[model samples]
Target: MEREQLIVKVCGMRDAANIESVAKLGVDMIGLIFCRTSPRYVSMVDSLAGFMPNYTVNQLKEMKNPSKSTDIKVAPKRVGVFIDEMPQTIITHVYNYRLDYVQLHGYENRIMIENLRRTIEPDIRRNVKFIKTLHVSTLEDVEEYKDYEGAVDMFLFDTSCRLGGGSGQKFNWDLLKQYSGETPFLLSGGIGPEDVDNIKNFNHPRFIGVDLNSRFEIKPALKNIDLLQEFIQSLRK
Candidate 1:
């Protein structure tokens, strides 16, 4: 089969302009950081507030207490990035944010993935997609997640960091060629403007898309829109 359409995901976005820029690229999705420890954490309730015009911020605000309501309307698919959070906290955010997907970026296991899938699927009206992120330091590390094959919706293979993904570090791309399994995955690592041609040459049926972060930045939480647009447009055949 031909490679799956590369999902150009612009993660860790904070402001409306960055969100708009990423959306304008027609990227598959944009991420909002909630982990308070991340510098990219979108702390400005005011900035998130600005999205009210294009989206339903009031609905997001209501998600403050899940005992009330858990529905919100937003565009480009709202993804919440979490790292080793308590299950209740994840559930509460899932309900409050009305998130479409929850990304497990920390040291979570098969049980955690299975338990998360069970906890939310029954309570929510719609199916919640789960993305299990793996931070690879070596090929051996990449081989470990074969057990979760059927449990997640997608696999996000990112470069390992002292903190994790937003660390903007990169690893060996050739190592991905060794990934032998049926699961589809995303390519993320010190990928930047220089790697587009190499990406086009990457021939894997499961190569879904590229996740762009630090390398495409003008600053933390801000993406260089023009550069992103140019890069995305180049992907067209």
Candidate 2:
């Protein structure tokens, strides 16, 4: 986390205004959960008066490189977080939401990831990047990173627990030291405002960022912007 400009991905985002506010915070990415079982699910939202229905790629682009925003120059990159879903299902979401990244957060295989990647529209292919999640608890799980080496654009190492999707728990970070893979990754699971000191001290060659969720939320998908502002400012300091 001490590395200069380490990316910050604020995940499980739901509210429209809240998403915009967080984008103004200069976060690198904002993730919307697509898993039906997830409380932060986007389907119930986007079909109605939520983000996907109103927010479009042009609007997203404007948010990113806005000419008049004092808060941040670029908006947070949009990401669609999915479980083990069909390639066509993923394709529809990617096209509908205009996501910048797709976080595969289930027991997805390399073929599944590659197929989805290859199936995306040729024009949209360049704009989308895939992030595969590696739920870690022990050395055995960490070593599985190699199996996904050539499939994804990046890896997200989250905590392994029975209660999935925003399990507010942390795995032993020391386990990541054993990950000898080359793909850069975002450290997830149980990260909070309190981790600034620990995150600043933690260093890795391929470690690129952090994924904030349950720990920073006021409820299922509502984030405490004040707390996040303090955390980001303090961490960057």
Candidate 3:
């Protein structure tokens, strides 16, 4: 497949400068974590375990806008990561952040996913995509989510850990060879600069993209733009 055909998503971004820098690199999607327990959570906090600071919806809006100093146009879709949040809360945040996609990183049932899709306004619903995260330790784990093929727009394969994600650990990619379901998936979990060669060797017709997070971060929610740029360039080459 051509380099442009592969979608690239940089997840767990919070710092505005870093967000814009990555966006300028032409990533296909930017993920902002909404799960409170995650170190990369984007809401009302400046540092790890700090007091809840007030954040206005405008912060999200600002990130989407172009920088005044440059004409760099960032066209990446904004994705919000949530963990078992209520349908209403998801819907509210979707609009508030102007998210183009919602990544469900919790153990939500089919009913909950359907309810979320049905509840969002038709206008927004038509454009928004839903991604269901599957924590994989075995091939059976991938098959178990087959029922959600129709409910979610895509599947994210992440390492199974005590916490939902940001485990900074990788799953067995060979396990995905057993996935027979037609749903396309984004390969995530501990993907960093060093994985470019392994990623290039990974061949699966249904593998549509890759999501990078913890491994590329200078700290939680702060990505190393230089490393990310090199990774992106390597992928293109």
Candidate 4:
């Protein structure tokens, strides 16, 4: 049976080759993590886990500013992921990467979101979308952020854990039925290629998209492109 179109976002990306491969698939969004705590953090200097030399500032600049010989085919909109970062710092990365959307995966309250909205440059702000993350474990978790409907463009629902995200965990999607907020949301957490059937069966008016992460990874920060391609194809089928 045909299904409603859903936005596909492959987050926690680091490798340049992998990024290019994923981009060519024409996924809706490609996420690059900026939070240091997460294994998927994009950095210039090599880190302890050796995920660095990964997605440095200069590399992102080069990707956005393509050269004559190096024709980068960026099909998906780049989404920058942040966790409790200062407003100015987040703004800097947004401008640096020419990010199309900023996913706040931290404990940023309404005030912080408001500050970010006000502080970001007008031109960038106009085009860039703000996706606020609501870590959910219960119905109350979804209710707490109701006041942020106007502050953000979309809401991302992920499983709550000690670590920010990329926990490779799935929340009780049933709890989302209790969400009566006006804004649409993307379902995340432990989503993998196999879950396509579950996603197809899941029904929700505000279900606009799905955020794929750890479950699709080859290792921490590196994605299994083939698996992702299959999942995307299945979603469209």
Candidate 5:
């Protein structure tokens, strides 16, 4: 299926103001790192729910608390970026935060993603989406994951490294030609302010978006809003 518009996701958002700033730019999604090891981890916050925008009361009534209220000015979809987290722990965040998407960046297989998603509460799970990350170093790295085609809502292709992604390095973009599956993918890694023209020129039927992280950051978890605004404006046009 062809997407109406390409997705522009700005990941690793932690600060309350920074998150609001990026959301105001009208990006499609905002990602928060749940992996503790990453310097951009959002777990340090006093309350994750309070730090993020509130989910509609209609979705999960019990998860809503006045103390958890935030003033994010835009409605970008919220995504919890996880690295091999337990099923129960992930389930709790989905309930507590009402995340719209769960992005998995690990060695998890299709079965793991499927089963973990099934373990979520039915009402909340129905509103959630899953994005599986593929650290691409070689063509086979993507070609071999054909089974994930239907299991995930989307796929993220990033430079292969020990940390999974956020290496601020680009892999051989041509390696994507090997993938001919139905699942759409987001191109990430080393996407900086200068890549707007290149990202626009690149084309593939399944390419649906771009994921920005390290290159757009002022620090690990803080994004440069001015740079982001300029880049997003250019990419969208």
Candidate 6:
């Protein structure tokens, strides 16, 4: 197997302390859940227990064009994870928060993905990349998403959970190795600190990243940064 850039993405981050730890670690991306139906939803006034100073979108925006050297450090490219949200609603957050990526985890068809892309094309400020996800129960499910290969910038194959993503249970890795597509994808599902060796052993050209969710969580919305740090460090080794 040839060595490739292994991207580590820490997902479902709720508060600031974990976010800062992840940012400082220089992971590729961090996901903030927007789906209210999911147990991992991070709402307004969510506790800042572990964070240095709490901030909202408007507050962060004011510091964006910092006049003082003490302006708050812009955190990792904020990624909003949505499932079945109205395109307009997604647009609102994307523009308001200056999001870097919109990860669609619902049953959004190819048309929806394209429409979302076209919706923000005229407005540079709202331009955000789309990452479509597919739930994998079998190798056939992986094959089913080929038509969408070119429609999305990246594909996230997560476990088939009752409520959709955030399930820490992993699917079959051998099935993923059989995937014959050109679209680069992230392997998600029940991935934990122990999965590092398994991932390193698996060989595939299109394997781009790993999505960590429940396995790295202390609770629904909180994360254990040490688990993530160990996992990431192991990848580097």
Off by over 4 Å in 1: 44-48, 51-74
Candidate 6 per-residue lDDT over residues 108-162, each given as its tens digit: 8898889888987668454577788889998888886776888888889898878
Q: Which tens-of-lDDT digit does each residue in 98-209 have in candidate 2? A: 7789999999999878877777847555658889998998999999988999788899999998756599999999998888889999999999899999988887899889
Best by TM-score: 2
Candidate 6 backbone collisions, by pair: 168-190, 169-190
* Model 2 regions lying over 4 Å from their true place: 52-70, 121-125
Mark the 10 consecutive residues where model 3 has the least summed lDDT.
49-58
Q: Is candidate 3 or candidate 6 better by TM-score?
A: 3
What TM-score goes with each of the models? 0.85, 0.90, 0.87, 0.86, 0.88, 0.85
- For candidate 5, the per-residue lDDT at 145 reads 61
Query: Scored by Cα lDDT, where does model 2 land?
Result: 0.84
**Model 2 — which ten-residue stretch has the worst lDDT?**
50-59
lDDT tens readout by residue for model 4, 102-180: 9998888988888787778485555688999999998889997676888898999999999878898999999999888
Predicted candidate 1 versus true structure: per-residue lDDT over 1-237, tens digit per residue: 455467777788887756765775677777777788987786548445874125455456556756654232335677788989888888887886677888888888889889888989868526889888888989987886696788888888888878787666778877777788777788887788877798899887677888888888888888898888888888755
Question: After best superposition, candidate 6 residue 4: deviation in angstroms?
Answer: 2.8
Q: Total clashing residue pairs per candidate?
A: 3, 1, 0, 0, 0, 2
Assess candidate 6 and give its TM-score to the true structure: 0.85
Report model 1's TM-score to 2 decimal places: 0.85
Question: Model 1, residue 36: displacement in angstroms?
Answer: 1.7
Clashing pairs in 2: 64-75
Using TM-score as the measure, name the better of candidate 3 and candidate 4: 3
Q: Alpha-carbon error at 34 in model 5, in Å?
A: 0.6
lDDT of 5: 0.82
- In model 5, the worst 10-residue window by lDDT is 54-63
Ranking, TM-score, top scorer first: 2, 5, 3, 4, 6, 1
Give each model's whole-structure lDDT.
0.77, 0.84, 0.82, 0.83, 0.82, 0.78
